[model samples]
Target: MAPRPNVVLVVMDTARACETVHERYDYLSELNRLAQTGTEYTKAVASAPWTLPSHASLFTGTYPSKHGAHAGHKHLDEGIPTLAKAFQDGGYETVAVSNNTWISEEFGFARGFDTLYKTWQYVQADIDLGKIARTKQGTEMIHALATRLAEGNPVINAANAIYGQFFRKRTDDGANRTNKWIREWLANRNDDEPFFCFVNYLEPHLEYRPPKSIAERFLPNDVTYGEAMSVPQDAWGYIAGTVDLTDRQLGILRALYRAELAYLDRCLGELRRHLEAAGEFDDTVFVVTGDHGENIGDHGLMDHQYSLHETLLHVPLVVHGPRFETGQVDDLVQLTDLAPTLLDAADIDAPELRDASQGRSFHPEAEIPPREHAIAEYMAPQPSMDALRERVGTSTDNIERFDRSLRAIRTDDEKLIRGSDGTQEFYELRNDPEEATNLATERSERVDTLETMLDEWLDTFERADTSGEVSMTDATEARLEDLGYLQ
Candidate 1:
């Protein structure tokens, strides 16, 4: 068989389709380029709210329930047919470089890759205590910038760096460097076999640490009236504190966010340039997506790991490269479908892949299925629910509030979230963009309809068999610990 397209999957952490440079920021021109050059899915949703599960869903084309990694720290089941393994079986060389501990080798994320990298150039875990940026303002900006950059919104890059007092961009630990690594990887690689590379950049995850010049640039003057104070370090269940800001502060916060995104965009642009120059662009299948969305202060929320608001659940997914048409797709797609789509696009029979995986391939001009929703779930992976709670409070830790465990499904117009004990919440997206109103008490008929759908969906999802303990590895334990996944 002819060599299939080389696949380079870039999973930005919190990217949104609507915020791409195409939608707004010109500083992030490259992302717009990618979106315009290939197929963009405006309705894509990450299968989960956080990294590990969402990534597992992305890599395996399966949901959290199907893959069974529901907590902060868990590994992918090595037994499952991961995208890398499946592609490798079809004679492709696969590699992954990730900056999040959630995706470290300790878990199954590294299972099928020929090479996997999870540590960031500057992981928060290893921050030099003395050098660490500590002010709430600094942290808030950092969180915002990091989120913007990580989410593939490059417009925020410069703003983040500039706001953080940066006079010039740093290449060593900056977007340019990340792209350089990818360029080097692609340029130096001499494999005759088709190759798949997964490069996960982490500039955009929270506590928003960017380069030195990026964190300290914001202050009270930059904040809006509403955001003049830092949101408490800890707030709602599963919610973390943010650089509290009022409406006036949004400009600074947004500046930081846009700056970070711009930075990453430049980085991605460089990578794309290299890929094109190397004559690899048209021959490769390129993808960009986020694990989930971050809540940057909507509904009084600071960052992600909080409520299942659209700000947290809706994500960006874009497919470029070869064999895909240039157009927009509104069909609802879960992150899990990524694995199969890539394989199918390559026209390679993925033996390790299973129909049970939640992902389905999207071939250009093909009639897609009619699945109307996606599922996201969260739970305590270990006995130390408190450990997870400390970072993002759960009911076990915050009994006065609601339970932390939540399972939700989202459709185009509405969303439904159900707590384990049957406490439910509903929202009308068109009216409640902030998700401030809970309609479960008021919309009985809608709740019933959604509940039935949820039940049937759960049954179908369970049949996928993503349960039980992940085959453990010391690496997984260490990574989980670093990411606060393992206590």
Candidate 2:
């Protein structure tokens, strides 16, 4: 039998299908080119909001519950069969290059891959782009910024510029690292073996900053942005906990996001050139997708971490390769499906044990069935120990019992979000993609249907043994902070 093709799967952090070259970004020339030669999924859903659990499912073809790595900055257990490991068993080399701070060799993310690497450490010093933005004319802008700071004038303008540039540059750097890793790995390839490689980019995630050149490329000519337009809006709901952003702030925040998209596109161009030159572009089975999406004021939320609204659940998933069809797949597909899809792409059978898996692989021409909805789960930020005790209405001794949790079941037209203590959120995604409406009480009939579905799915949910507590070591926390995670 002919050898299976090498598979290259790229997951762009927080990059939604709506903003990619094939979907919403009209000016994405590079993305357009890639799509011409690839299949793009118009609507791809994420298994979870954050990195650890999301990638865990993507690699194992299992849910976070099954793998037990449900929180951010936590290690995935080495016992699971990562996609790379499956490929390795089939005599294929496996490699994973990631820019995610929490997903590193220090954590169990490095298991099974022959080559696993983390990108350059992003630091406070990289905020210089924001500094440059404040200084309109080099020395003069610098002087103005210093004077404002020294005179206690808020230096808000300087901060804005710095913020804008920081996110932009950081995402650009992420794309660059992806290309660097792919090329370096490919150069040392053993011709007889197939390989499964994962390139994780941190673009379009948070601390939104895009490169200067890339930013101007996407800005609206009509608006004049100010220094206040730097940080994206703080999350909604926990109103007091969020940073209220002004209109100017939103504009600059959007520019930073667009700039990151541009950077991802640019890096993709370089990657394409390299692969095509090496005669691997057409022969490889490549997947361009995101683990989850950002909430840029969608449903009044700023970023991910809160709510399973479409803004967070709806991610982009595109599959293009020799056997896959070029048309889009409208079926509701989750990150869990990736593991099986990839295994199928490589002509490898999922382990018999995986038959109990919740996801199924997609065939190139097979018709995908309609799903009732997609699922999203979160371990909401915990309340203080005192608050937990109060909420549990029990003794403070078992503070461990209260782990503020939330889960969602999102359909094409509606969503049902359930929180601890039976709190619920309902939105008709068709009419309100922003999920501004909560129909849990008002639309009781529909809620019942979804609630039943949620229960059934949960019944089947094989909760991973995370024990519902996550605390990274200080060293690991440092890495996560560098990746813009909340420390």
Candidate 3:
């Protein structure tokens, strides 16, 4: 039998399809080149709208509901087999470099990794004692206090205004740092053993302060980080109709986001160059994808987990390797499909999943059946909504709507979003790609059929026994709060 090819999975955290590849963003040249050389799934969907669950789906080849690693259930069950374990069982070395705390070893994400590098662990080591509290426990307490003080106090707000500027400088860019580590690993790893490398790049996530050189390329010379930070940290003020931002300020925010993407693109190019120099480029299967998309003021939401809109669900999935057909694939695909596809590419059989994974390999040369629709789930009682409402008053109806759990199903031309509160929204994607209009009332028949299909599809997965809030260390919780995952 032929030796398995080395696998490299790149997860661009908070990267949106509309911003990265589908639109006129020329900064991602390397990714574009990969898509041209390989296969690009034009319409790929994530199984969840946020990190933990979406990433679990990608690693386990199952939906958030099946794997039960969503907001309702904060950890992946140990019983569920992951793609890393499958590869390891088949004699492949598995390694991971994750930036998000939710993907840390504490959460069962390190189950099969031979070498796991958590970027946050390194960040904690480099933290300045003066900027943050002296001790880890003290820092956690300060974070909790800050959360409380941020509610409505003018003094705290003023302090936050000042602290926000320095905060951007406190942390190093995770994507660039991770790429450096990957290059070092390539130099040290065994040449004979095939390896699976999982990298999570956090450059595109919040607090978008690109280096001055990168930022200036996108913005005017006069713009500064202070001007960008002038907009509310989470833009909750804009969402709740409290603070009004000038047109120039909004443009600065967009510029910062684009600048970060540009930085990420450069880092990706560096990784590609390193792989080529090591003579591993030809023998490696490269898969680049986004865990979930972000909402940059789309649908009046600042970040993800607020809504299951296309801005937060549609992500880029590009694959390049031997035996893969090149060019664009128009069929609908999910992030969950990536695990099985990677395993299949290596000629490895998938392990017996707890709730049989719904993903199928997209090996283009093979006669695999295409999916007609894609599903995404969001189980929310988002803690951020309360903080947003407290800072800026919003309607109770809006709050209720944002708090409701949601499930979405999308076809090539249509989408249905069903909320737990019994509210439904349907959009004709061809005409309303932005999802500006909700036609649920007008297209009752379509809604009914889609809802039935969603229900039937969901029925296949066995319900996980665990369902509750995730337990976290004080320091971990503090880190999540700093990242805006906690209130």
Provide the TM-score for each candidate, comma-separated.
Answer: 0.77, 0.81, 0.88
**Pairing residues by index, what is the TM-score of model 2?**
0.81
lDDT per model, in order? 0.64, 0.67, 0.78
> Comparing 1 and 2 by TM-score, which wins?
2
Q: Candidate 3 — number of clashing residue pairs?
A: 0
lDDT of 3: 0.78
What tens digits encode model 1's per-residue C-alpha lDDT throughout 3-82? Answer: 68999888777665445624455556777777787887877777777787788888778777777776533667666678
All candidates: CA RMSD in angstroms? 9.0, 9.1, 6.2
Model 3, range 10-112, lDDT digits (tens) per residue?
9889888898765356677888888889888889899898889899999898887778888777888898899888888888989999878788776779888
> For model 1, what is the error of residue 207's alpha carbon versus the real structure, in angstroms, after optimal superposition?
2.2
Off by over 4 Å in 3: 123-171, 220-226, 384-396
User: Alpha-carbon error at 319 in model 3, in Å?
Assistant: 0.4
